[model samples]
Target chain A: MQYLNNIGTYFLMIIELFRKPTKWSVMRHLILKDIDDLIIGSLGIVSFIAFFVGGVVTIQTALNIDNPLIPKTLVGFATRQSILLEFAPTFMSIIMAGKVGSFITSSIGTMRVTEQIDALEVMGINSLNYLVFPKLVAMAFYPFVISIAMFLGIIGGLTACVYGGYSSVDDFITGIQQDFQPFHIVYAFIKTFLFAFVLATIPSYHGYYMKGGALEVGEASTTSFVWTSVTIILLNYLATQLLLS
Target chain B: MIEVKNLHKSFGDAHILKGISNTFEQGKTNLIIGQSGSGKSVFLKCLLGLYDYEEGSIEYNGEVFANLSEDKKRDMRAKIGMVFQGSALFDSLTIEENVMFPLRMFTKLKKDEMRERASIVLKRVNLEDAHKKMPSEASGGMQKRVAIARAIVNNPKYLFCDEPNSGLDPKTAIVIDNLIHEITEEYNITTVINTHDMNSVMEIGDSIMFLKDGLKAWEGSKKTIFKTDNKIVTDFVYSSNLFKKVREAVLKEQG
Candidate 1:
């Protein structure tokens, strides 16, 4: 029942978010600011995690397939498949639910605790539209972050395969190309886009409606992170069932 | 002028405002004073349309707020400006940017024109020299001044200030009080202040409403509050010995 309530409130918030829009001139600045905060600010952590996770995938695949009958190039295939299908999109998004999600929650929650949101509402500004819409628009570019992740992941896998004696550079490169399906990349990005919207809005819901003061802001951020990660996982499962299965 | 008639508000099982009815005159600093949990903030928020009322009407220049369409309500809200207790300045913006925000959002003025208008208000609040600083860098008094500058930058018809002097020194509090008074008179804006600052009450509270436990305990001017025998209003106002002596001296002067 609580889950149902949350889902209902989340949808209602989305409805309110699109109404009474801020002026485009104002929205443009807000979107730019959010892009800077949510996207540009997230690049370093995404890159670090992607590279290391991709390397681990390559090493794990190579060690598990010790049989000579299995082609060494399968290491690269497994690495690319795992990175694109799961690591880059789903797993990295879980990280974002912590990084970007907490950011949105804490900032907006602080604003609420401080009466900044009230000031906006009293000024006739739609605080929801003013605070959340820009994030939704900015998250439309979530693919850019995933694109970086995909690039770094593949590079890290290639480096790992060559240096770790898992496979020769040529075989790994060949494996990456052998059955390269563009649609899988599309599938990954479709999930990325969906999760991006999830990441932007769920935390906003927790923060915007949060009550109490400074301590409550911390609690709200934690709750937002937990809920965002949980929702992303659920949506990932649902999307994969529909898109992949 | 703003008027509230038989106002009542509640949250779940808790009633916060009980039948509050009063008029806050234009061109004057109208104050609502009460101890914590006395519903002054709730009353002010109801007037601002930040909170919905269970029963009653809040009117601005005779336009019934509850009956207005969303568009109409928004239009009414645009005519209002508010100073939050914490000043509520946008953390990301410099003082100048904070003051220019409403103009940037609501008007189509050119960049230079917006800057010029922001400068004019900033100067009005005596914040010209602190324009480039962030809200965090400014003193509490300066932040309050910046808030005032932002609130009036759009030339609102009604100004709502929630404890504008909450964190200021007594001297600075009086300065802020006087500033609001001057602005209210100059713009003919109906200014409503929610505060428990006795200094403010005695200084610029042209009209004062005292609340006790969600009910209107007393309503009178600064002069009448001194002459009245209402213990609820007097006890809260004179709780401190210094203020008690001040009130006794005032009554003696009156006698």
Candidate 2:
């Protein structure tokens, strides 16, 4: 019965989200407050993953073929597929789930345990709408922006490849141009939107239900990040199979 | 007026409120007093619909509040105001914005009208120039006053306060108690307060309900408290060493 109730709550929350999405001002405020944290915390990790993953996949693909019939430049095609489809969106959300998700869960859980949520309820404000919706909208939009940042990290990797004489700039660009499909960008966005939803809702739900004092709030944040990261990885595999297949 | 009928709440196996019933009249300070973990706050939360009781009904102005629909509950909640125990002010908002929040959400009043109303309530709470200050900048007593301003800014039909004087110094506690009493009389609202402060009970307790171990052990006015022969009531009222000595001295003088 508790499980059923939780499922019901999720559906109700989704409906609530649709009924009154976050106000523009509130979204703007949350975004500005979190921008520095998101960029600083997520950029380095994503940059490292993007650069190293791109170079490693390029190197591995180039070594696989013994015959020179297949262009060695096709290594860049594999790099492009890996970066756009699976690496950028998934890796960024996993990193962000640790940074932004934990921040939101702890902040809101503290507010809940401190009776701030009750204060809003007494004032006839929908506490969920005021607290969670802004975060959801911000997370939804912000990840798309961060995915662009992830793409820049890929460019950094490409720069390294050119400077190290492993590949020419024209050849790398031609490899990407040959293999790139517009649908990959669409697929990336769909995955990003789904990741954002999962990241925002799971943590917000955990925080909203926090009951005890500071200790419970800390536990909620830790649990939210752990669960959200696991769910992101699991869903990444599922979404890739569904979309790419 | 507020009427609670046979309100029962239990946490798992522990019954918190057992068949508790009371009436809180309008235009007076109706206080619920008890020791820590005695369920006074829980009862107040039940009344506010923040807790779901397993059984019983609460009526506000003769309308049943327990089984109301979501929209009805929301509408009813708009007519209720609360001052939380910790003075739960929005940390991100300035004092003026905190007080102005409900007005902005519930009313289509012009911004100027909302600001004017907020200022009026702030002045009523004796906070005239602290509008621009954040809640963190205010003292504990000042935060309670800001909370009170926010509570009454909407001119609610019912006011509920949970430990309104918990952490303040004696003098400021008295001031807040008096202000809450004055507002209760001025607005003719049904005001319910959950408190353990004996000073508050003495000063503004127009009617008081005492809960002991989650049971309604005693109910009476301040004037009748001293005269009542209930042992639990007497022990709670005169438990302090100083109050016990005062009580003994009074008895000796009477003898």
Query: How do all models score by TM-score?
Result: 0.97, 0.89
Best-fitting candidate, scored by lDDT: 1
Clashing pairs in 1: none
The 10-residue segment with the lowest total lDDT in model 2 chain A = A18-27
For candidate 1, write residues A152-207 as lDDT tens digits: 99899999889998889999998888788999988999999999999999999999
Candidate 1 CAPRI assessment class: high
Please give the TM-score that candidate 1 achieves against the real structure: 0.97
**TM-score of model number 1, chain B:** 0.97
Instruction: Itemize residue pairs with steric clashes in candidate 2.
Output: none
- What do the candidate models score in CA lDDT, each in turn? 0.91, 0.82
